[model samples]
Target chain A: MGDVVLASLLLPLAGAVAAAVAPARRTVAVVTAAGQTVLAVVLAVTVLRDGPVATAPGGWEPPLGIALRVDGVAAAVGLLAAVVVTAVLAHACASPASTGPATEPAAGRSAYWPLTLLTLAGLQAVLVAADLFTTYVALELLTLGAVALVALGGRGAYGPALRYLCLAVLGSFAFLVAVALVYARTGTLTLDLAAAALPPGPALTTALGLATVGLLVKSALFPLHAWLPDAHAAAPTAVSPLLSALVVKGSFVVLLRVWTALGGDAALASVLAVLATGAVAWGGVLALRAAALKRVVAYSTVAQVGYLVLLLPLVTPALAGGDGVAVDVARTAWQGVLLVLLAHGLAKAAMFLAAGTLVGVAGSGRVADLGGTAARAPVVVTAYALAGVCLAGLPPSLGFVGKWALLDAALTGGRWWVVAVLLGGGLLTAAATARVLAATLREPGPGDGPPPGTPHGREEAPGATALPTPRAGERWPALALALLAVVTCVGSAWLADLVLVGAPPGVGG
Target chain B: MSTAEVYLVLGGVVTLLGAVRLLTTRDRLAQVIALNVTGTGTVLVLVALAATGGGEPDPVLHALALTGIVITVSVTGLALVLVRRLDREDDGG
Candidate 1:
């Protein structure tokens, strides 16, 4: 189990190296994606059965060397990551649009897979690293890979990519400052030891505040989220899934780590909840108003992030009075948090890929322009609808179960306002998703579909094809993903038990 | 409060100024430079933080600082390339 745990960290790096050296791109892509997915599943099971897995690579102990630990939360996230990555990679490989100019850089045919694998490696490292310094470095690597990926966009990509790079680097510097403060206070970078050494004082509080703010910027929360929509909306079709679903969530994983280590200070969680509420309303409004299909999905990501943030306040409601958190409420809330992370990751990745497919077939990305997708791309439309079910927290979806757990937790604590916030976020998401669904399923006039007679839509790029409907290659991958999403929701009860396997003892047990 | 804190304060001031500049400035070059300045401040703060112990500084801290500098430099290089790309986009189509 420990070896598998270690292998999960090394596998992505190994895959990157393998992809670089291999002559064939398709084989390397499949081998790496499949291998990583298997390893992630093994780790998830290991975390469930064994509680927590810890290993110090090269046998160097503690502050000097690095310790990599996988708790239930990390492993559960790893599982979500594995599923999403493999599915997205499969979609990218199968989808005709993915082979276009934008994804193919000047580097080589093999370059895309390596960069993606390397980014996955960095993200995995960030999740498993037991030291702050290592997490920061890993995060930097993640951003570097992501920046390169984002810049591969068409003509307008450069500006958004540059902005992302600047903000991400600045965010890293803030995180570094916080790490230094922790080190100064504890003389060690190991998270557990440093957390133990944290006292209620100016230095610790300041460090936490700086770190939180920095992560907020990186995670694209609320006012600081200016860079996200343009960058995400403008990226190549295949790349948006990686950007929106995984890369943006990386910082929040670190924030979760920092938040946990800080012992979930109630006052701070309260402030975070306020920001989250605003994000829910703000992101929802923007999504509802956005004209572009991809932009709507991007803005919805911001809104979903708000629900994830709400976990902070929901779990630690008693923190405000210094009475300590109620363990039962905290536990249920923790369950809610884990469920939200899992459901959102899967559903959002599916949404991006489905939206990408819609853009590919429709010849336009505008919400108002997405005419006749149901007839033209039925499989993809179905995928989009299933993903929407998850996003909107509809019944039997993991998303619904997650929110149900959260609302239940809130009700237990009698925090009715939070219950309202969660309900509002769901409604807003449903309304926005309805807009896309309606636009997509709307009847295509004589003007819609690839201009009259072009075969393969060659003459009309991004235009409606006269073939009526795209066949299996593009359609199957999305259907598979959507089916998995529906299956996850239906199986959510058992899955919830699995995720709660090694959560903190007092949380959602 | 202490000699090391003096260094910490100075680094914080530098980082704050640079962060404000990075956020406020629309000029690509200025933002890149601001990022570097803020990065430099973080490095200083890390070094100063190590000094506060009144003993030999941790070697890991030095290595970590070097890593930060390397990453910052690479990012700065990448950002500049992107900015140049944007300019070309303007020049042509």
Candidate 2:
């Protein structure tokens, strides 16, 4: 498992470099997809069985050489992420990718291949990183790779790309500052050691605050999420899933590691939970009102993130206290959070990919103009609806099971407010789903007639690169990803059991 | 103040000014320049924090700071590229 983790971390990078220099693009895609998926799958299987796997390059201990650690949580995510990357790459290869934004369509196919794999490599590194500096380096690498992907969408891409870059840099800088501060004060760069030595001091508090703020910005939580929609909305079809699903998850995984490593901070957890609740409500409302379908899905990404962060408060009582019941509840809530994370990643990736298909068919992103997609692309509509089922926490879906576990935890822990927020969030998400479905289902509005050739053209918002017609090769990947979302629903029981084993060591131990 | 303290103070001031400039300015090039200044200050702060009463810098900390420097350079390079593209687009070239 240790060796597998190492391979998973290194292979994408090696593949990226090879892809860049290689004359043949298809070979790179095939080899990378096979190698990355195999390694991640093998590692995930081992992790579920063996608990956790770790490796230190050259056998040097932490505070010295870097160590790569992958726990069950990372392995689960890596497994899903590996599949998503493979599917997207396959889609990219079938359609010429690096039509390098609108400006440099001549930039050649190699342009997209390298960055795509590089993003995966960066994500893998962040997942396995055991030390703060290692995570910092990997995070920056991931940020760069993601921004490149966005910019690759061409001409109009620069505006959103620049905003994304600035915000991303700012967030990563905050994270870096927190990292340096932690190392300086504690003289340790490893999570467990630093958290252990961290005294009750202003410096520790400041570092925690800075790290959270940075991650929140990176995660695109509500108000700090201004850069997300346009940047995500504007990216090329294949790029959206990677951005919405995994790039954002990179920082979020970091946040989880930092908070849990510190055991917990109730005050910060409470404040963040409040913000999470706000995101759930605010993002849902915005999604319902969004003019473009892609932007709606983007806002939903922000909304789904709300569910992810609620784990902080849901489990904080146990992590921050000595109460046995709280610990019991924390265990359940932790499992629920991991499930939600997995479900959202799959659902969002599927939704984005499917929505990209519809946008292509309609030739415009306008929700109202998206009419007739149900009749045109039922497979795509099915995919979107299935993913939406997860988002809305409908019964028998992974989202429902996750929300159920969370609700149970909140109820048992007597965190009634969390319960209210959870129920309210589910309803709001349902509303957003209803809005998209109704718009897509109903006849075109009175003001606008049926669109003609390339229904997506003419209405193109300034700076929005026209959504290309659906590529025949990309449909399978889109449908496969969405089906996987459905499979996760059926397999929720199995997944919950597997994930619960990975919950952090008993709080207050 | 001691030499180290003076360096720390200077670094702090530069970093603060750079952050303010980065936030307040709308010009892409100006933001990139501001980020570079902030980046340098960040390196300075890392170096300053590495010092102990032992009167010597930890080589390991210096290595980490050096890594920071390299990463910052790449980020700045990317930003400059984007800025250049923005300029070209604005010029309608």
Candidate 3:
């Protein structure tokens, strides 16, 4: 089982190398993606059956060698990421060669595959990393691959990609500085060692602040989120799913782990809670007003992450004298937040992929120009609707399950304000989604002729791009991912069961 | 203060200064330079920490230093590409 865990990390990396060497385009995409999916499944099963597994590289002990540990959370995230990567690869395999002249040589495609693979490996590494220094390294690797993938879209993508690269590097440096401080103060890089060395001292506090700020920037939580809208909106559609779905969550997972390992300081927890509320309100408002389809989804991400931040306060066990109701609320809230993260990954990936198809077919992403598109692209529209259901926390979706849990938690914890904010955020998200649907469903204006057929268009023209409409074949991947997002609601029972098994005693609803 | 402590603070100051410049500067080229300086300062700080023998010079830190160098170069290349593209677009317009 341990070997399987190790192999899961190595398989994508190996496939990436092979993809680079393979001559055929189909071979590169299928081989690497399929291999990763299989590895993801194997690792998920191992984690479910065996529980969290830790392995130290090169026979070194804690605080000296790097350690990888896959707990319930890491396994779930790994499996989810695998499903997303496979779906993306399937889409890439079936879609036509992107319309632009090949800015990258044949070899560059091979290089691209390897970079993505390395990124997946890095994400898995970060999830399982037991030491702060190892986590920092994994984060840097993830950023490098993501930045390259952003730039892979050719000249038009250069500006946004450059900005992403700069901001990401800035975030990485801040994180590294924090890691250095922690090590200097504690004389050990491992989380266990640092926790043993902790008492909320100045150095540790500074380290925590720097690390939190860096991760927030990377996660693109509101205010620090200026780079995300452009990066997600501008990147190639195929690349957008991975960027929005998997990469951002990677940092959040680390933040959660760090918070857990740090033994849950009250002041720090409250600070995170405050920031989360702000993120929910600010991101929701911005998402509601965005005009571009992709930008709307991107802004929604900023809001969605707020729910995860709220989990920090909930994860700490309540004192014995505290209300028993509060304890149950905290556990329920934690589970809700985790489910939200999982469901959001699936739904966001589907939304981005579907939006890409719509953009590909209609040649514009502006809500105003997407008129009559829902009629033309029923399947795509349905996919969007399903994804929106999850995003809005509507019934029979995993998203609803998450929101219910959170609302219950907030109410029990006497945090009525958080509950109110969650409800308001949900309503705002629904309104934003409705705005897009309304524009797409409406009849074309009298002055408006049939929308342009091409995918690429004049800079000034709203919907004049010349790319081909999505055929039946191109729609399956989006549909499949969307279905998974919905089916996640059913799977929640099983996930909840697993989470309960691992959860501390007396910590549940 | 120990040399290690002095260098660590110095590195932090340098990185903080570079970050401020990067954010405030309008010139694309200058922004890239500021970012690079920030990266350099970060690496220096990490090296300083390792030298202090607080932590055992863990391989992860070494790995991070290598990763930082590679990423900095790659970002520099990408930034230059964007600068060139902007120049081209301006000329064409």
Candidate 4:
């Protein structure tokens, strides 16, 4: 079991190297993705049967050698990553959009396969890392891969990629500073050991504050989220799904680990919840107004990130209450969080892939251009709408199950404000999603072409028969992911059980 | 105050200055330089922190500092390449 856990991480990294050298980069990438998916399922099943699995390489343990553990949370997240990454790779394989003019540079095209594999490897490392410094290193690898992937979008991507790099690098330094302080005080780098040894002092508080700030920036939470939309929107179509789905969540998992390790603080949780609310409102409004199709999906990611942070306030021991009540609430909230993360990753990736397909058919990225797309690309359009419904937490989708659990937890905690935000955010998300669906599903009016002499619309001929048909490869991957997002809700109870095994301290057995 | 304290203060001040300059600067090159300055200060702090142990400098912390240096170098190289790309794009126009 332990060997399988280790292979799940190493295989992708090894594949990255092989892809870098091999002439058949895509084949290398595909084979790696398929293998990793199998490893992830094996890891998940082993953990489910036997509880958490852990290993300290070379028989060395914490304080000297790093520990890698697969708890319930890590297993669930790893499974989500494997499935989503495979679907995304399948989508990329099917679509020519991955090698479009936006990725025209030779470096961009060839580098994508290796970078994708590297990112998967990095995420796996981040998931299992038991020490602060190791997590930091893993995060840096993840950031490097993500930044380079953004640059693969060619000219329009350079600015966003650079901005992302600067902020990400700065955030990493701040995280490193926190790690140093942590090591200084505890004389240990392993999370559990350091948490146990850490004295509550000015240094501990400072370290926690610095780590929170750094992670907030990396996770792109609210006001610190300035770098997300452009970077995500401008990324090559093949890369955007991975960036939006998984990379941002990597730091968030680290944040959850750090916050839990040091003990949750009510004040910090409340503050985070408030910022999350801001992200929901701010991101939804912007997404509603976003002109481009991909930008809408990008901004929606900002809003969804808000929902994920709601877990903090709900799970905080001080805020949730005492004894089994607290444990119960925390467990419910954690399950909700896992469901939200998984559902968002699958649904969001599907949305991006479908949006990419629509853009391909329309030959432009404008939401306006996507009007009447239902006729030309019904499968992709249906896929986009289904994913949007999942994002909005409609019935039968995994997102709905997740949000229901969150709402249930909030009600139990008697946090009326949180309950309001939960419901209100869903409505806002539905509205924003409706904007795009409306555009795509609407029939083209008789005056589809520019009236008289509109200069910008001159190039677009009305009812142009030149629109490309989305291939089965392009169409099927998005639909498959969308279907998975909805079908997974059927397994919500089983997923909740999986999340309970080796659950965190506040969440009971 | 001991030598370690002095180095800690120096590192903090340099990090602060670099961060402020990085935020305020409009020039991309200057921002990249500021990031490097910030990185250097952070590494100095990490090394200084090791010395505060009141014995031989800690190997683990030194290793962390070395790791930080490598990350900074690679990131800086990537950043400079991005700046050059943007510059070329502008020139092509």
Q: Which stretches of candidate 3 lie over 4 Å from their true place?
A: A62-64, A97-112, A316-327, A446-453, A457-468, A499-509, B51-71, B74-93
Give the C-alpha miss distance for residue A163 in model 3, angstroms: 1.4
Can you list each candidate's DockQ?
0.80, 0.60, 0.50, 0.75
Q: Positional deviation of A422 in candidate 1, in angstroms?
A: 1.2
TM-score of each candidate?
0.94, 0.93, 0.90, 0.95
Q: Candidate 1 chain A: worst 10 consecutive residues by lDDT?
A: A451-460
How do the residues A1-509 of candidate 3 rate in per-residue lDDT, one tens digit apiece?
A: 66766777777777667666766645665676677678767766666676667787677765567777777777788888888888877776666432112444454444555666777877877777877877887887788778777766655666777788788779878888887777766767787678668667687677877888888889887678888888887776777888898999999988776666555567877777788888888888888888888888888888898888888777665522246776787678778888889889999988888887777655667777777677678898888888888988888898988888888888878888788878988898888888888887888665432343424421223553432456665587888888888888987966665444334333542
Best by TM-score: 4
Error of 2 at A55 (Å): 0.9
Interface DockQ of candidate 2: 0.60
Per-residue lDDT of candidate 4, residues A273-296 (tens digit): 899999989888888899999999
- Of 2 and 3, the candidate ranking higher by lDDT: 2
- Residue B62 of model 4 has an lDDT of 89
Order of the predicted models by DockQ, top scorer first: 1, 4, 2, 3
Error of 4 at A101 (Å): 2.2
- Could you give candidate 1's per-residue lDDT for residues A1-509 as a string of tens digits? 66787888888888888878787765786677788789888887777776778888889986677888887777877777777778877866765355234333566234667777888888888878878888988899889888877776656778998999989888888888888788878878887678778886887788888898888888988878889999888776667878887887789888877876666666788788888999999999999999988899999999988888887776554333323346667777777867887888888888888887787677666787778887878788888898888888888788888899988988887889889888899999999989899988889777655544443212234554254455566666666766676678776766676667655433533
Deviating ranges (above 4 Å) for candidate 2: A97-103, A444-472, A500-502, A507-509, B1-6, B52-54
Write one digit per residue (lDDT tens) for candidate 1, span B1-93: 888889878988998899899989989889889889999988988888878887787766778788888988899888888888788778884
What do the candidate models score in CA lDDT, each in turn? 0.79, 0.79, 0.75, 0.85
Better of 1 and 4 by DockQ: 1
| Residue A480 miss distance in model 4 (angstroms) | 0.8
Which candidate leads the pack in lDDT? 4
